[model samples]
Target chain A: MMDFINFYLVPGITLGAIYALGAVGVSMIFGILRFAHFAHGDLMTVGAYFGLSAVWLLGIPALAAIPIAVALTCLVALFADRAFYKPLRQLPTIYTVIASFGVALIFRSVVQLVWGTESQVYSVGFQKPIVLFDSLRIATRHIQIILATAAITLGLHWFLHHTQMGKTMRAVSDDPALASVAGLDPEKTIRWTWIIGAGLAAIAGVFVGLDTDVHTMMGWNLLLPMFAAALLGGIGKPLGAIAGGLIIGIAEEICTYPFFGESLISPSYKSAIAFVIMLLILIFRPRGLFKGRLL
Target chain B: MELSGILFYLISFLIMGGIYSVICLALNMQWGFGGLFNAGIAGFYAVGAYSAAIITSANTPNHVGGFDLPIVVGLVVAGTLSGIVGWAIARICVRLKADYLAMASIGIAEIIRLAVINEEWLTNGSLGVSRIPRPLEEFFTGRESEMVFFVFVWIIVAITFWVAHRLYKSPWGRVMRAIRDNEAAAESVGKDVQSFRTQSFVIGAIFMGVAGALSAHYFKFFSPDATEPLLITFLAWVMLIAGGSGNNKGAVAGALIIWAIWSMTEIITQQLPPDWATRSSYIRMLLIGLFLQFVLQRFRAGLFPEKAPKLNVKSHG
Candidate 1:
């Protein structure tokens, strides 16, 4: 049991936390902007790279660079929306989706140009794990990631339920027409959506970087799973995205566990788990688990 | 450049342009006619490349079937296999909204990629399938053989173009236009929108598979590198959009023009310092992405705007 907790469960939770943060952004964007936002993954890459830049330039710890990463990623998101998406608002949503796909390539290419294609670690070498409850072993970075995600989730909950802007965001997401008729500025709501979504993606990107070496494809690779989580939790449902993310993240990791004296699945095929799960959901629960808007 | 060098380059360009034209037309069938957004052209392309490679290559201990069959047989199997996969996916995802379908199709393509990479016994993994035979490769050698192959690819392109045009003039084409323009109205008129979309998806997939097979034959090899989304999927999308989505001629022209630009840009990028070699490819990709943004915003209908198909019979009121 301790072995299971140490090897499978802990890593799963850590991964789940990262997915939850990313999925929050994907879900929010899908709800508000009414597009898939393919570039959202690359936004995470941008955030992680920004954090790396801060660490390289300011000599700050990776954790200390979150503010810079979040801010820059938010800026990128807003600029992308303004330049690429806003014009296509009158066109079909697929136009924006196609544009977002292009934006994804653009962001990744820029990152590859600036940072080189090679993977880099946020911090040098590995840290020893701290023993918890005498039998459990956990890394300090994992604790930081999980706790930070929890804190963010709580903060998001408070903001969404209590704040004026948060409530307006929810209203806009639920129905842009009704919200606009209620005298809410659609543009303002969109700007806020990008800010929150990109900010969370940056943090998730940093967490991924903290856990493993940061590479250009890291965020792209994670994008599908984050999307799966968003769908699983239900689009437009922030809390549901959190739950969805945790389930998918944990499911992906735990699927490779050795349940019957042999691993249940080869690690090489582990990525397929999310795709399969997502396919099943699309077929049976097309509206999503939380019954989000069909669009 | 030397005349011979230029000639070789020209041959290579035309051959690739011909292959991309077939791909662009297949995309037109799906996106233009059916209004289905298939972002995973690479997936169908990979299936074609691998299946063709396995069926026609000389026997080898490295991988599965080197059946040494005729190239035509290989091409047929490639299309059949890919069409089946497309059918399965369409059955599952055809009802999705356009955005959802795009995401799902891309994911399906990724899964296909995963299978190609991991199923080493079938695909030979990252090393890819080799010693594949090109059609009429045995009859000629050197530049002459290439010229022959060039003719072969263009022949396929011609057939693809003809089929696309014929469909445009057909009654089925009219119904598809109705569905594309207004799905609810098509459904209300008793046209099975879902079934037509599936047929369009399968037809497009078969052609895409054939296009992939042509490429594999052109190179005399097959690998994951050739199936890169940037080169195959995204480039096709750019070509179709740039050429004109609904027009068959536009699809072909777009493939040629975009491909010419893609090929010629390499000469400029190759001039950078050796240290900037890797960075140059990224720059090229960035340029392409930016180009896509420009085209989407500025050129909505493309150079060849889609014209309404000529109706042969007068409808009685």
Candidate 2:
């Protein structure tokens, strides 16, 4: 039991944290903007790269570069909205979706152009796992992931519940026209939403990079699972995203469990597991777990 | 270029264009008429290609397929299976809006790609199935055979085009367009909007299957790499949108134009210095991204807008 918990459950939780953070950002954008931001996964990659550059140029600790990366990614998201998405705000939602695909492509291409196709690590020294029990071991990176995700999620909850801007943001997301009529500044809310959303996404990206290696394809690879987590949690519900993310993470890891029999399921099908779970959820509950808008 | 070289290039271009036209025409039915967004075009295409490849290829000891079936039988089976898959997907997701369907399709495509890669018994794993039977392979060889296959492909594409064109002008087409314009209005008029959406989606998937099978036969081989969504699925969307959705002629034209640009970019980029060659693909993608954005922003209705159906009655004013 300890071996199973250490091997599968721990990593799963860490992975879930990444997805939860990313899904929250995705859900926030979906709620406030009412369009599937397809470039979002690439935005995470951009954030990770920004973090990598910070660590490289500033000679700072990998952990310390998180704030710098988050700030920079927030600006990029803002600029992307103003330049690409804002121009087509009046168009149909499908148009925005297509534009997002284009943006995804452009972002990915820029990453490939700037970073090439090679994978990079933040700092190369390997840290031995700390033994928690006779056999159970935990990596420092995994611990960091859990701690940081908890802090951010808690901070987000507080912000949404207590802060004036957060309330205004939620109001706008619920009903932009009504919120505007009620004296909330729609543009300001939108800007702050992008900031918080992209900042969280950057943290997720940086942590994932730390857990594994930073590569141009990391975000693209994560996009499906992240979207699954978002949709499963309910498109616009932030807390639900965390729940959905954990479910997806556990399901994916469970597929590789030895009890299943090695021939029964391959680890390569982990993404498929996430997809199947989401599809099944959507088939039964189209609005997802928390009753987001059906569409 | 020499006359023979030009002829060869044109034949190759049109053959590729014909396959893409089938895919784009199918997309026109979905996005243009049905208002359904499917991001898994490549997935369905791969299914068709692999299905047909397995059915027609020579039996190998390592894999399950190798029935060596006839070309027509393979194509039919490919399209039918793909249509059935689409039906299943439509049943599950037709209620959702276009973007959700888009996301779902992406997931579906990735799953299909993964299945193809990991399931060695069916797909032969990464090695992929080879020696797909092309039409008229026995009679002609080399470029001559290719030319014959080219004509055969165009004939199929033409038939598909004619059928799609008829559908576009038919009453059913009007219902589809009606549902697309306003689902609630169509529902109020007693049309089963959901059923029509499913039908259109299945029709589109069938066409995609046919397109995939045709391309697989032409290439005489297929692997997981050929089915990348970024290359096949997104490109199909670009073709349909650029050529003008809701217009079959525009769809075909868009396929040819994009294929021309695609091939030209490849050739041009390959000629650059070695370092630049690696980067050229990214440049190509960047340009395509820009082009798609430009089209969406400026020409949402596409170059040739869907023609308003001619009303028989005269204006009473």
Candidate 3:
């Protein structure tokens, strides 16, 4: 039980938190812009890299660089929207999806050019785990990551419920035609979507970097799981995405646990867990868990 | 640089081009004719390549092999297996929106990749299946066999092209186009949109598998890396879109041009400083992405836009 708590449960929750951050963005972009936004994982990668840069230059802790990551990632997302996606708004959503794929490649290549192909840690060497209840052991960084995610998720709930822009975003996503009639600026909602989505994604990126080493493929590797979380929670529902991410992140770690003296699957096949879940969700409940729009 | 060397290189180029042509043609049937968004071409391509490698290779201990089947048998099974996979996914996603389906396809591809890399007894994992034979290896020696296989691949390409062209003109093809343009209207007109789409997807997958098998025979070896999505899926998409999506000629031409660019870029990248060697592939990827953007922006219709066949009309005199 102690082993399960220490090795499986804690890691799962930490991963879930990171995935939740990324999924929130994906779900929002899916709801508002009306495309899958394939470049979203790349946005997370950009954020993490920004955090790495800040840590290297300013000598701040990785966790302390979250604001920098969030700011820079938001800028990239906004610029990507204005330059690549805005022009194609008049066309089919598929055009935007393809362009996003291109944009994903662009972001990754630029990262590689600047950061190189090798994986780098924010600060090398391992930290000792903190013990809790004289039995459960957890890393200090993991605790920080989980707490940060929880705070952000709570802040998101507040913004969505209490703020004018957040309410307008909800209105547009829920019913674009009616929202247009109600005089909501779809473009304004779109800008906010990028801001919120990218901001959260950057935080997620930094969390992932702190947990492990930062590399070019970090975001792409996590993309399927983040997408799975978004689909699981229901599109355009940030709360649902948070729930979905926790579920997937936990499932990924727990599946590899040596239950019954045998791991359910090889650790190498961990990503496939999210893939399978996404497929099942698509086949059974294409609307997602939260009654997302069919399109 | 030398005449003989250039000739050999050209043969390899054309053979690879032919393989890509088949895959592009398959994509044309899906995206061009059927309007299915399958971002998982690598999945089907991997299925085909691995199946061919396993079926034809002689007995081996490292992985599942020893079937000792002929190259043709391997190719056929490759197509069959890939077609089945396509049918299964197409059946599941028949009612899905194109955007959603595209995302799902990427997931499916990732799943397939994981399976390939992990299932060692089946795929030999990363080491891959070796000693796979070329078609009619006993008849010709060394370089001559490459020439024979080169002819063989083009013959297959021609057959695939003919099939795609015939399907485009057929009444079934007409229904597919109708569905592609507007699905609700097609359904209203009593067309079984689901069945037609499944057929297009399966047919296209069959050719892609056959192309994958052809590549296995050409190399006389197979590995997971051979089916990289960037090389197979992304390149094929770029070719089809650059050539012209609904046009068969455009697919072939697009494959050739894009393959040429892909080949030449490697040469240019190789000339970079040794310290920059590892970064060169990323540079190539950046270039391809940029090129795709240029195509998507400037030539929405591609280099050779679709030219729908002229409808016959009789004058009333």
* Model 1 residue B175 lDDT score: 87
Q: Which tens-of-lDDT digit does each residue in B34-81 have in candidate 2?
A: 989998999899999999999999888767878999999999999999
Q: Per the 3 Å backbone cut-off, how many clashing residue pairs does candidate 3 have?
A: 0
Candidate 1 lDDT by residue in tens digits, A221-277 = 888888888888888888888888898888888888889989888888877887888
Better of 2 and 3 by DockQ: 2
Taking chain B only, the TM-score of every model is: 0.97, 0.97, 0.96
Off by over 4 Å in 1: B313-317
Q: What CAPRI grade goes to candidate 2?
A: high
Q: For model 1, how does the per-residue alpha-carbon lDDT over B118-155 read when each residue is reduced to its tens digit?
A: 99999999999998888787788989989999999999
Model 1: lDDT equals 0.90
Query: Which CAPRI category fits model 1?
Result: medium
Query: What RMSD does each model have against the real structure?
Result: 1.3, 1.8, 1.5
Ranking by lDDT: 1, 3, 2
Winner by DockQ: 2
Q: Put the candidates in DockQ order, highest first.
A: 2, 1, 3
> What pairs collide in candidate 2?
none
Q: What does candidate 2's lDDT look like per residue over A166-192, in tens digits?
A: 888777767777987899877787798
True-vs-predicted CA distance for residue B270, candidate 1, Å: 1.5
Clashing pairs in 3: none
